[model samples]
Target: MSHTANKDALAQGTHHLIIDGIEQYYHVMGEGPVCIVHSGGPGVRWDYLRMPLIEAFLKLIYLEPIGTGASGRLADPRGYTLARYTRHVDALIDHLAVGTVYFLGHSHGGFVGLRYALDHLQRLSGLILYDTSPTTGPEFGQSIEEALQRFAARHSIRPEVPKLLAAVRRVFAAEAQAAATDEDATRELQQIFPVYFADYWGREREFAPLRESVWAWSDPLRGQEPEPYDVRGELGRIAARTLVLAGQEDAICVPSWAQVLHAGLPVSQLVVLPHSGHFGHLEEPHAFASAVRNFVS
Candidate 1:
């Protein structure tokens, strides 16, 4: 289906939370048990994945972490520690008065979700990991450094809004086109790219106020430093039921990471979606949403 069609498939709503003196943004839709969706990067906004699945979910909550998107940027980089982030989740839950919730994290968000489970397992009904890793392996650490360097270089250029939007459109279109050949694939690529691109640009605009802190938080990682986390030792401590999903073609967070995550979580199931990449939710929305509904139910 086209991106528009996919979006049309979703029922959405908006809400906000104030935690640690920052206005944390979130979108809420559906009703039942609450399910909070966390973004992959500490910097990525939550809009990319907030959609009709909310209709199927009891409730879907999308949060933009502090120092990114609509949340206030902290002058102190030390304030960006992982523990502080987990606390942000805590604050949001408390602010919303949500007694219990299902935690869904993509990429880095997955790590954060697991960390939350470690500390607040009683608050979670289950855990959903999308294209995420339990820990950053040696090879993954090197890759993260490379990616940070690339982001640093891009930050230096500081491309204008138009240029950034155009670039996003071109890159996603090229990738989607390269990945699928069927007419349905082409139509979906054309439709979804713009919607995703628009959401990305919306985040870019919302992110303008916090560019400095965002860049600062990302700068050190460009150099040789151990990755920010080592959660492998603590995975088994996660007491919540977990479902792990990996894209068949995700080069960044490879499928093996999902396998590793599954092995660590005693109550976890793994699913690998064929012909999909890092953004499996977008690549296979129906399947993605179905898997989530099944597990969440």
Candidate 2:
């Protein structure tokens, strides 16, 4: 389909195509070089990654991704792996007929983007790894734990800090067991969202809507891969120029993780949004958009 057709399809809500016997839905906005965006969460909904600012300068293609939002579910939710997500990206590029597009991934979506780039480097013009890390295991967990401790310490004065921290523990525990239901995951994610911000309480008026609006589901297979997710050894192979964006105070994907990615990727730039957390695109929209715009341009 042509770019015009893609826009028209998005105008109605979202555009989708059948890939590997499943529906792959995506949202397109703005106009310029086509940039395909993959939101985070093995189960989090895609709305949280919407970049209206970046849309002003690029044709943003946001994937709903399998097992999320309006997209088709897998026969087994555990089937939502990076490989599967990468295949959908490959197909989406082919379906869009926009060869060598810019690819952006946030959080878990960054993992998907990295897999796609490593597997299909020839199909990409550039890559943006936002709020993501190069690996997930003990080290990553340690960093997150440290970050969370800092967050708790920083916000300890607030009456709600303890509950938020409790929710974080509960969610992580549930994720480890792959036992959370969609409703349960969604509620826990919302309750603990303040931990994701540099100052969510300070800016509750601006960020609360996103906290309340967040949605998630459980993927029984998630985090159960035989091997821990690590691509440090493979990062050298990705020749596409990359923008490694991170939030300075991000608890989940800390600046240290972004630094690791920046150090590994040969041709890359690192931009850490100073006053933001995991959701820099929302907390520091202008900086996030400018970094992306400059990188793509």
Candidate 3:
């Protein structure tokens, strides 16, 4: 089927698509070749990655994963598996008839993008991984704990916050094992979202733009990643010109994981955002957009 925009000429510039009987929404911005962007969030909003700077260099197609933004809700949380998301992207690619798209995914979206390249490498011309990991090991979890502890030692974070942090991880682990969605789990995630930024409290305004945007959470896909996300063995399967961007202080995806993720891709360049966290693109928009522009051009 042709992309929804084709259904009506008036629909041009509107970001919406019908995938698998549900109407899904994705924003289309800028001009030139398409660079499909997958926003982070097993259920996060796509508005965060709408970087005009990058759009100036390459056309950007941002996807709203199920349960968030204008996308349809999944009937079954179990359907939120990594493979399922990869397929959603595949269907979107076909539905749009945009050949050999340049895929860019952030956080969880990066995982899906990497998976897509592994099986459908022929359909991808290049790949961009922003603040993501190749695998989720006990080490990554431990590192987050350690970082929190270290941060506490210096900043004296509220005592109750630590308990909340533990609860956050528990919620994540539980949902991952069950492969389901829970609004309660999502609330817990938003509660400790600050841990994602280098200066969550101090640099509050830096995230102001997103403050007004609708940040929705779905319990199905992200938390329900059935297995430990270990794509290390399959990294070599990606053959596109890959650009790996990591935040130097990213506690969640961590720079160390990015280092190894970069090392595994045969053709890849790693750019560590010297002073940013998971939302490195926001923290360093100019540099971030320039990196993307330089790579694609």
- The TM-score values for the models, in the order shown, are 0.68, 0.94, 0.86
Candidate 2 residue lDDT tens string, 209-238: 888888887762353454678999999999
lDDT of each residue in 196-289, candidate 1, tens digit only = 2112333455433333222212311122223457788888888789999987656457777889899998899888887565677766678887
Give Cα distance to truth, residue 239, candidate 2, Å: 0.9
Alpha-carbon deviation at 257 in model 2, angstroms = 0.6
Q: Give per-residue lDDT, candidate 2, residue 137.
A: 74
- The runs of at least 3 residues in candidate 2 whose Cα sits more than 4 Å from the true structure, single-residue gaps closed, are 1-13, 173-175, 220-226
Better of 1 and 3 by TM-score: 3
Question: Which candidate leads the pack in TM-score?
Answer: 2
lDDT of 3 at 53: 82
Ranking by TM-score: 2, 3, 1
Error of 3 at 230 (Å): 1.1
Give residue 48's error in model 2 in angstroms: 1.3
lDDT of prediction 2: 0.85
Candidate rank order under lDDT: 2, 3, 1
